[model samples]
Target: MLNGLKTLFNKKSVDSKFGIALRSQAGSYALDKGEDTDIQAGEYFTETSESAGDWLDDLLSSHNFQGSGHLVLSASHYYNVQINKPDLPDNEIPSAIKWLVKDIVPIDPDEMIADYYDSPVIVSGTQKINVVCSHLTSLKKYTDSFKRYQVDLEGIITDEFAFANLLSHRKHSTLIICQQPFEEVFLIIVKEGQIYFSRRLRGFSDVGGYSTEQLSKGICDSLSLEVQKSMDYFERILKQTPVSEIKVLLPVKHENFIIENLDKNTNAQVSKLDLPSPFEQMRNCAASVGGLIEFERKGAEND
Candidate 1:
């Protein structure tokens, strides 16, 4: 009953001619006007919980985001410590991280520079929070790294925001699977283009390092868990409307089989997400390329 209404509303929204919302990720960029694109860029420098800043700086200096458009550096490994059932007042929310860092995270919170924002909590009436933490030197290193590549860095945005931006057209509940070559799988739930939830699952890989048989089984099993979690989240917490569709975007090679297997695992229609064009289609430039499109779009709107 409610699902029908939501579908009708989504259809109406599409029919109303609202502009397409655009989005970019670590490896892909997509919009409503046309096809989506993938980018092929060289390795992105990454560091674990306690790495030195030089490694990250070296990574940033190798690429370019200037003139490409609006680009966001969505560093995924940040310590996103969050508490749901907060007993504090609304304004006091800022201190939540300070308290968390002191007791929760492994590294010294003071040694890391952190920024936080409040998100509208769709489920519980509790306040929702997002925190981004990185070493202060690491921030400078990232900036210096871009300078090394001679790519003009426009601005930085968190990955979650970028993920939400791409799915803006979804009025009915939707599930998005974001796969990077060696990183964990990211699952995002979109309702009417609003992000209801996001989570990252570790130990997932798509690189050719694994044996063919292992890779096949791994892809299917990982996707299976992703589908299950998406369903569980929709039913147990969201309870707004069931996910009407699931879109899988795998940037690695031989992902077709994985995508095909995903369709068989879930009732929600599954399909590979397409790229917009040369920007996305360019060789080995997925993440950087998508970042460029988004950067350009935001610049145009502001102008």
Candidate 2:
């Protein structure tokens, strides 16, 4: 199933040329480009028409940009689940997952692209594998949107994996709570450089016409409960090390309020998420930054 999808772009050398990384949400898109390890340029825009292809053309043409490269799309149209590692050959794992999640997933197995990440740790001959699936129809929509521009898609990755890539260098167990405008908050737990658990919660973003204090309180209350649940599950169900710290990534305007409120509610030390050097203004572009980092890491591995 998804094994073929995962290997679709491997036939090409990732470092042969430069590429563009794109993240879209709520009719808006952000484009990023880098040469070698340095990000040289970035652009953010909103679509005014139904045709995403037309919008992309206007953006690239307006900036006089040209070249074909890998496209990394940041989307939430995927599902992540944990399952026990089956006692089967590597080639049979995909079919096993299809059968396992056929009823769990809304769409038919034939209409989905599926992949999985085996837990870095193997305990008692059992492994926790994170399964990721995206609908074929949604994938086609994204591929078709960029095909008009002759862009080569490197991969379509979920925000969790992209964000995990951004935090790949961290050696400690940590909980990351990311609040994005108009999108569900992503609560991810990472341990030993791998995603241990992940969940998404709604009602954490801005409320139209609501006061800043009111919105902050609502977000803090909801976030507090989710954070506590994640911590308890990590320490009890997973029986792993306790998370050392809780990192919150949100818009700069809400950082101070969130820090103040979240600090009072959670035992873990809460602080703003630190961005990599090239992402100084990444408050609203966290996922895009992560996607760029993931793309670069893949390219380096290929090289």
For each candidate in the order shown, give its overall lDDT on alpha carbons. 0.51, 0.63
Evaluate model 1: give its TM-score.
0.68
Q: TM-scores across all candidates?
A: 0.68, 0.80
The global Cα lDDT (0 to 1) of model 1 is 0.51
Best model number under lDDT? 2
Q: Summarize candidate 1's per-residue lDDT along 1-303 as a digit string, tens digits.
A: 001111111111110001111112223322222223323334333344344344544434333222222334444535565655356675664545555655665557666655565543546766656665655454454445445545444455545555555443666877877755555567878775456777876656444355557656665776677678768877787556677788766666656667677787787888766544443443233444445445555556878
* lDDT by residue (tens digit), candidate 2, 1-303: 133554443233233222343444432323444353434435455553245445556655564333323344443557777778777898888767867777877778889778777877555557878777777775665556445545555665667766676575667788988754555677889876678888877665453335567756575677688789989988887777888888878754657676778889888888888767756675566665665566567668888
**All models, RMSD in angstroms:** 10.2, 3.9
Error of 2 at 135 (Å): 1.4
